[model samples]
Target: MSHTPATARHLLRRPDGDTTPRFSYGADYNPEQWPREVWDEDVRLMREAGVTVVSLGIFSWARLQLAEDVWDFGWLDEVMDLLHAGGIAVDLATATASPPPWLTTAHPEILPVTERGETLWPGARQHWRPTSPVFREYALRLVTTLAERYAEHPALAAWHVNNELGCHNLYDYSDDAARAFRLWLRSRYGTIDALNHAWGTAFWSQRYSGFEEILPPRLAASHPNPTQQLDFKRFSSDALKDHLRAERDLLRRITPDVPVTTNFMVMNEMRGMHYADWASEVDFVSNDHYVLPGPRSLDELSFSANLTGNIAGGRPWFLMEHSTSAVNWQPVNRPKRPGELARDSLLHVAHGADAVCFFQWRQSAAGAEKYHSAMVPHAGADSEVFRSVAGLGRVLRELEPAAGSGRAPARAAILFDWESWWAAEQDSHPSSRLNYKQEALDWYSAFLDLGVRADVVPLGTDLDRYDVVVAPVLHMVPQPLAKELTRWTENGGHLLTTYFSGIVDENDHAWLGGYPGPLRDLLGIRIEEFAPLLDGETAELDDGSTGTLWTDRITVTDTGTEVLASYRTGDRAGGPAVTRRAAGRGTATYVSTRLGPEGLCPLLARTLQAAGVPGDLPESVRGRVELTVRAGADAEFWFLVNRTDEPAELPGVTGEVLAGDAPERGEDGEAGPLVLPPRGVTVLRRAAARG
Candidate 1:
């Protein structure tokens, strides 16, 4: 075993590796909510709570611009001065997330009308129409003004463009949006003939002869075609991207040096915007992750972290929003049990998060988010939550500058594509029960259980370095991606794709030849017919265990292909559920049904081991505990976090830091499992070694 040096390089790092400032401890602070007299107290409390940076003006558009032409920065200027005087950096928000009430009131076109044709009333933020020219002009003006004013501010560290975009489900299908959609289609297809072919409109007597005939697919009396729906999804996503690009371009003109970013909500699908497309324009990706109470919260966090890391192209990311204690949303809002927040924070760091910031500094006094958790509760600085924030601040102050100094190294990659996600969801044949995220979670959980360091990459990424690649629900088989996967499998790289993979083109149209489409040769299996399972129905696998959801009948096409698990459902009661094919020096595995963990985990483990990848972590690490590795120049840091309240012991051979001693071993010469108190975390540094 190569003794991994316990070095600082495994930690998160600045872009320059020297001059770029490592993200410091921060929280979203809306001092504009409070009076000027309260500034000193808030600053003092922030200093106590270890907040080195504050994200300001996130939802202050209405306040900043009370009138059409008048702009007010007097209070904002004072807040910036006070924060700078107190040695705290500011992530200056462009304040474009929400338009001022006047803008919406004066120009109804800027207001987003829902699918039901209900125009959003005033006061709600994120209600502006993405494609509205008035919105575009005004939003750009706000961004330009902020950039020009704060471009040289000594306190400014970065620019936050608006709050979370696309938070709401509504997208305008108004006349303005319709015209914009036509323009977007014109740019994409160039001619109506190509658009007709892509949409297959000839089937429904919907072939458009002119660009003016096109309209965004809005809710109609009849059920809309999947192709039209998919196009609308794509159009809305593109419109939002165009909005971001416009603001980003203006910001770049004024402040070319400071990084610009926007906070994105995780697992949000309505807008059809994936991180991959946004990553191209952003300096770095930041996400607001809300952990709902459940067994899968940790897994969700890991998935999000991996997604962000992948979007950054192995670059470090920032945690834009996390709860300090209890969340305000959810029917049952529960507080974080003891050390859960800290443990989650460190896990973010271990998973390539350069900075960790909460949603808020002080608790809200009014509105929908009044009860949301914050570093400072309504009780002020004397509260226990305040003490916890202060304690965390102390730890971060001591550890962050050094610990957040490097990126993690990963060898395995999982491909996540938005086109695939959209295509899978739009498929009329497959069971509506076939969820994309659940399938992804199944594969991601397997990787986590095995302690494999894998990056969740996009479809178009370079895959040469990865030893194994997993593509779940790859419904949209882009030609380039199909070729890349073929090349990868042919080059001795192991590949695995799950049910609902490789079924459609970019237009949500089924591939002409066979199921798995372009990947059929690589998979060596031809899917004949898809079988959808009804609710409360179950089908058994060849392993004699029952499975749920949809199943498919598959036949081996090549001599190298072999059935691993067979489905027992409908007329194809004994059909293969999983199949493997030897392609050149490597192999490909195809799963035809959504299998539960019992049927999925063991199969994944066996496949990974066959591919010479580590399939299991030490048994001493509890099943609920998640372990991730981040490598540095000399050392690798193992972040072991117990996301639950149950006590879990650390694996043997690891030294203890919080307890300040080497771990004691059992009779087996393994270190005694360290009991992690509920929501507790342990970070162990050891020599980087390959199994």
Candidate 2:
């Protein structure tokens, strides 16, 4: 495997010879809500809280334009000037998301209609139709105006275009949207006959003889087909991409140097927007993460943060939006425990974040997010949240120089594909209860448990660098990807895939042959039929352990494929539940059922051992201390995090960088493991060696 130099991969850097600031700490600030007299106080509070960057003008459209032709910037100008004077960098928003009432009122065509054909009222945001010419004209005007105004401002560090593009699903069935869909189809399918064939329009006497006859698939509940629904999902995603490209192009024209990005809500299954496509145009990725009140939330957020960081290929990204305490959107809004916020923030930075920012700086006086948590509550800066922010600020100020200058070294990678996600959910058969995110999480958890540093890489990534590549639930088998996987396996790279993978294509259309599609040859298994168990039913495995959820009946196609595990009961009792095949100099493993943690642990452990991954730590420090190593120039950095409540001991034979020691480790033959307090993270430097 060839290595890409560290210098070539680093996209963001501070001024030459300048010390990099520890990841920028800040939140979404809206001085627009307060008076000019309050600006100084806000700055003081921000400085006290160690807030260095402010995401400004996110929803300031109403203030930017007061009338159809009349523009207003009096308050905005003063706010920027004050923030700049305070030495706070600004992530200036283009304010294109929520247009002023006058524009929508003047042009009703800009308003989006729902799937039920009801047009949205003016008060709501993200209600504008993407295809409307009026919306395009006004959006461009707003972005260009803001870019030209602040293109050279010293305070502007980055450009944030439209807050959460495609917040609302592309639901328009109107004439304009239909026309645009037709044009997109024409460009993709080229001919009407190919479209008919791919969509399988002949099944319902619904063949489109021409492009004009084609319409976006709208399936009624009783007659829904997976193929049509899948196409609609693809079309909707493309439409949203078109909207983003328009805004991105305009921003690039004005300020090409400033990185432009939009925040993505991770685990959003309904949107169909994949990071693979969006990453092509984005400078770096940002994610809005909100954790529910449960043990699962912590792990879920970690998975998302790592996934986003990996999507950028280890480039520095930001925690674009998170609540300081409680989130108002859920059915039950719960606040984070005293140290949870700080712990999570460091965890993000340890993983890959270059900045830690929250959703809102101040509580909204009114609106849906009125009750959401903030740096300063509605009760003012004397609140507990404010104190926490201030304390965090002091810590950041002291540690920013050392921590900010370092990055993580990951040697493993997990393949993430959007087409597979779409294809899996769109399948007509199998349980509707099957969730893509949870499945991905299950596989990710396996790696996390073993303390393996794995980046959630996109499908087309160069696989030679990774010793093991895990693709869980790869439902769609794009031909190019199948070929790549085959090549990787032949070159001696271990590949692992799970059930319901390789079943469909890019269009969600099933492959002509049997299950597993093109992956069958590589997997060396031919599945005859799959048995999906109901909520309470169970399927037994060959080891006398029971497996629940679902199972598949399979036959080995090649002598190389070995059955690692099998079902223990039912009609297909003793059928293979897990199989492994040797291809060329490498091996491929295929699991025919979803295994719970108990069933999955041993399998994953064995795979890791075979791939030459690191050993398991002593059981005493398993969950308490998390370790990850990232390669750097001439050395490697090992990040040790204590997630438990009490100080814990560390393993011997490693360099120590405890709170007060010099940056060196005493070579003691059997030194006791160092003790780490609750929620603390330590970075230790060591030499890098190839496996």
Candidate 3:
């Protein structure tokens, strides 16, 4: 019998290999929430709804373990058997999402403690601290029990670890966490002297005498030590990862044939858990995403989906959880407009989602998430959401033809780092307005405007694949990583970095000699001082647009570099606001100001041209309608979406309609505009002609 590997390249695919369902649909199934009499009906409805896979027992820890040393698998066994009989597969959970109430009561210390020194009450779910040994022991016991019982169940398809690790208790400042933090620091920096130096603790006489003396950056007299905070974030992420690894090992030892995955909140990476670091541990990656409510909701979805797809190494991933309509958690839960359900789901597929599913199969009658939309809405199967759900199930089955195709390779790459995201805007900086994520999204949105499907990749990913790399706010740069980037640019990879990048090292200490220290040579400029503006202030630029938030007084050190754009009217006016240098065979463009999309978009366009990356300059790509194209060896699929309520038309486009049929191509393959209805999405697949 074949088994999942225990290392990096484990069962990245399903256990059954190519025979695994190409397109699967389902929801988080909680049979334990309902009576046994209802289980049979749930299974029947699942079959009718075309749910081939069900994620079972995600939050049933309390029910599954009854009492310490006493177990109850009878209900679960019945549920699994009933599901299999109804032709549904299982994404079985270890039931470790939350510890049983008895376990938590016995060890109240297992409940997470906030940085403010308040112990979290256990009324809600996932209350256990990530670093708590008591929590891990109980959680692992539950994991072992589940794995042993369902080692080779016919219904089992994948092993799901604890639900969204560190979602609630990502930052726990309890005694258990303090001990773990010291150990983590010892491993990262061997001696007390090294730790002191890295943290620059000598400032404010904060020098640590020993690792044990160090505590989490508790409400400091001033801003907490930046490096201490950074390391704490690092340690917090690692503690949760270590727990996942242990559970994964236990599953592989038992149900070695099944692939294992844990759902990720990849959109936010909430607690600084660099998912790029955790990507290799999971057999296959799964992500839970909800649309960010705003005018740019669709754009956010596309950006996040692309980011998740890239994090999966461009492999197809699972849409583990998305609300069928409005979600209960947001401040203003807006129900999805008609046609939005299918459009949003297909958007993920266009990017590279192999499976599409929602957070729940049935709506909860009571609970915190009772109001959240579901496939079987509270209104019943005849509701609009239910029809959309059933229609999507059929639509996904038809889209099975496109499953497993690789994400199209890109000519450009964007560096989106979790470390930079964490440390860049930490309390003490030139501007509290140095928004790391906004800068990234600006560059990414500009790329989408140019019809460029740039990979929003991690910093550590290999650079050889793309001709152009865009690093927006790469605030922290380690020497080794800088050297590698230097080599890539010298060997002919075009790079573009913005104002706040390359300023500090991992420890939040300035890079010594210059503002953008490690990257000074590549950029061919030295920034003498930071000149960030107030929120309302703006600096005029040569591009006819204005820069905001941050600016730098830059001086060109090398004669070979050229000035691309300069501040027209400011203290640093015409002092090389943006500079470019020919680094050997390639080029490096540096922007020394916060040039929003208005200023950065054109600069990005020029860089794309220099890098020889081809893309259309159509109105659809640049306007309210967003266009993305995915290509397979034999076909090209175009996803034309109208982001606004107004109808949009894509000029000179022609293809066979795969979804929404679009408005129309010209007569019989003649080129004409592709019409998109209000907030509509269309997929057009053009098959390559035979030789």
Candidate maximizing lDDT = 3
- Could you tell me every candidate's TM-score relative to the true structure? 0.92, 0.91, 0.94
lDDT winner, 1 or 2: 1
**Candidate 1 per-residue lDDT over residues 1-691, each given as its tens digit:** 2211113222222224344335478799988888778889988887777787889999998888889899898888889889988878888888888777788779877888777778887765688888889888888888888888877777887778877777763367888888988988889899999989888888768888999998777677675677778878788877777777888778777776677778877642332666688876777678788776666777777887777777777666778888888887689898876677787777777777777899899898988898998988888888777787887776555444335434465666788887777767754555767788777777787677665657777777888878888898898887787888898889999898987788887787788777889999999999877777889888877687567787777888999998887766565677778899999889999987777555677777777777787733565553567766666556666666775667666555364253112455688897665566677766666676664
Best-performing candidate as measured by TM-score = 3
- Candidate 2: which pairs clash? 408-630, 409-630, 409-631, 540-568, 650-673
Task: Give the Cα error of residue 363 in candidate 1, in Å.
Answer: 0.4
**All models: lDDT?**
0.75, 0.73, 0.82
User: What's model 1's overall lDDT?
Assistant: 0.75
Q: Write the per-residue lDDT of candidate 3 for residues 451-512, one digit (tens) a residue.
A: 66688888788899989998988988999989988999999999999988998887888988
As for TM-score, the candidate ahead, 1 or 2, is 1
The positional error of residue 276 in candidate 3, measured at the CA in angstroms, is: 0.5
* TM-score (C-alpha, index-matched) for candidate 2: 0.91
- Model 2 residue runs over 4 Å out of place are 1-22, 219-225, 268-271, 398-411, 544-546, 616-619, 643-647, 653-672, 685-691
